[model samples]
Target chain A: MSQPEILNQAFELGYTYTRSTGPVVGRFLTGLKNRKLVGIKASDGRVIVPPMEYDPDTAEELSEFVDVGEQGEIVTFAWVKEPREAHPMNEPFAWAMIKLDGADVPMIHCVAAKSESDVTTGARVRAVWADETIGFMTDIRCFELV
Target chain B: MSEEEQEMITKVEAPVYLKYNFTAGSAPTRFLAQIKKGVLAGQRCPKCLAVYIPTRGSCGRCGVPTVEEVELSDKATVQSFTIVSIPIPNNPIEPPFIIANVVPDGANVSFIHLMSECVNEEVHIGQRVQAVWKPEDEWGYSMDNIRYFKPLDEPDVPIELIGKLTVTGEEG
Candidate 1:
């Protein structure tokens, strides 16, 4: 029997594709990567966090970017008793809708808290970004109680 | 593609996580069981009589349920074949390997499998091939039970009869 030629090839069992984030959402997230926050003004003059390209009610095109503050008040939240595998936090935490200093409507994200007893409707929190910030949703690891 | 046209499309990369469950129905359950036991199984349609290797539990032609389970031979006729050369990430096999569709005797539908044993050029569309199974101890509920199909010493079937697996007058 003769030995066959062996070749070294690189392969990975994972997804390989590039997605385009349009100019509007792209700039807003780019701000987060730079440790800065940005918002967009809606047609009725309401500032929106995680900016939208169009006003939902008026169907108006929105582009004016507004710089928002890092600190925000929790509008409403659901406390996790036991975290699911998919949840961002493994320990007891709260998934909250936070109204940042300059935004009109709230943005939804997870909050890191010592206990469920610590979080409340009007509790103040600030963004605690990941050690290495990239233009990713997880770049904001979670908000910590301020 | 021009540089300005390329600039129009911005590319971003991210790792995605997804989870789901597969529900193998009664017919596929039977098929998997046979593979685990080191055998090939198919079901015969009651009306059309066309056999399905991984039985859909119903015949596509008559929409009639297939109930009679039939044992199939490991040997098969190569229906189609292609040699892949371009390297793509996550490909299970390396470049220059053959991916072919082979229909086992008494089975009407063709199933995809890897072809091996002979050098690249000798493989033909009507080639006679037999399943080269993994060691019996390693058999499980997967088509991987048969690692690949190897060329047979017998002559290739006539060109017109090459791809046909269903018996005469039973064509669908």
Candidate 2:
């Protein structure tokens, strides 16, 4: 008797998991949903954008929330000539460590620019909110040169 | 963060989807070869003497690699089972099916598999069963090669041999 053909099947794997974002992160995501920018004061009174629950160096608790401006300066950036699959944008963009107005510390985010020549270490940029905000880090779709 | 904002922070619901293909490790690679030839291979732990089906690289109890390979008999006993009536998504079988932990002959530990060729109500501890394989060509490098364990129409496995299959059960 002839042998039976090999069996092969592809399956879809999915899971739905809900978790608490905690007070600090929840407040920041809520701010993004409302098209507002917010940061938290670190242990030593240094404003840390994209708030950390505890100060990294001192390990002190952080809770004081401060409203920050949407516009910020690109303290430093890396130009992506060829974007990878996980990159925010398909076209060439720069991943910048931005220091938003009124915040002492810089936060890493992607900045949209025409080319490497258009992006600079001290270039000013502003947050571009998504069309429909759902309280996610991706809510700030991407930053654009101001 | 203010008290009002803390109160407003509710549970965040997010559904994750991912796809991955894993390479079969060395032990699994050899076990797959045996399954392709319609055989169930097991590795025995030198220290604990536990027979691990689909041969594991190391013995959990001994913490040593099993160098000897042994072929296990197709016949096994339904040492334990559960009648799953809940309709869970991604469940291979329909509701009200029996998923059993059957100890193949001469193997110390039991292997979990679906029990076929017997009514859900008839499946019980010590019920003798036999591995029913798919067509030879349909065989693959997975436990799927054995479609299911079916009734053997024989007496229950020996009481002494059945031993303490369950950890919570008294020593046999």
Candidate 3:
């Protein structure tokens, strides 16, 4: 069979996977549950949003946590005409990497705007939390253009 | 970094589970069905003389399609084996079982299966054995058919007499 045929057949059979994120990510999830956007500042002073467990540059374990502002500035974005499975939005939306105020790096999230024209770089947005959350990244549905 | 900043961190619980669909291939489907019938089946490469257990549609070595169906003899000789103490994910069998590569009489290649009905010390290279199949009701088209391979009371054949069958060398 062709590669695509093989892939299609494989998809029909069910598979499940469970991942265990280390301590750093676990702490970050707790902060999100309390409606806080936390960042981990590296030794070099770069503050990473969605605090990573390991410093990307040095590979050292991160322990410091700082609360960041819920609002952020969109650095770059893509008009997602075709939303993929489990995306915050089911309809056409914009996915942007926004640098939360006081955080040095950007965090990827959906921009809940009616149209592409409604979003652009430097636009202010705020975290839109779900009515109910189970501590996963989906807790924050998307960011609404402020 | 300040000592006060490090002291503010605490552990938290983060549970993540992902689910997706996985489909079986045609060759594996047939293999599973045969296991349900308490039968062990292998796909024979007519051109290469290689018999693939839990049969493969294509030969890895010769790059040819294995079309000929062969009912491999239940009896085989252990070539090499490993004792699996750790659990393998999604496997139905329990841990501490012996998995071995057994070369059936007249087949050039070895097939992997559980080695049972014998003590760990009793398992050795070149020992003659036969498959102990599970009940028909317990069968599935998987290697689970022959529950395990047991030691044969009879004598083993001479190693020299067991010739390596090669497709490139001669016609079958």
Top model number, TM-score: 1
Clashing pairs in 2: none
The runs of at least 3 residues in candidate 2 whose Cα sits more than 4 Å from the true structure, single-residue gaps closed, are: A1-16, A42-44, A54-64, A80-82, B1-9, B13-20, B25-30, B33-38, B41-52, B56-71, B78-101, B106-109, B115-127, B132-139, B150-172
**How much is A19 displaced in model 3, in angstroms?**
7.1
Candidates sorted by lDDT, descending order? 1, 2, 3
Candidate 3 CAPRI classification by DockQ: incorrect
**lDDT per residue as tens, model 2, B41-150:** 88878888777876778898889998678787788877789999997666667888778998777677788898888888878888888888899889867798888899
Best by DockQ: 2
Candidate 1 chain B minimal-lDDT segment of 10 residues: B1-10
Q: Could you tell me the C-alpha RMSD of candidate 1 in Å?
A: 8.4
Clashes in model 1: which pairs? none
Model no. 2, DockQ: 0.33
The clash number for model 2 is: 0
| Alpha-carbon deviation at A64 in model 3, angstroms | 6.5
Query: Candidate 1 vs candidate 3: which has greater TM-score?
Result: 1
What does DockQ come to for candidate 3?
0.21
Candidate 2 - CAPRI tier?
Answer: acceptable
| iRMSD, all candidates | 10.4, 4.6, 7.8
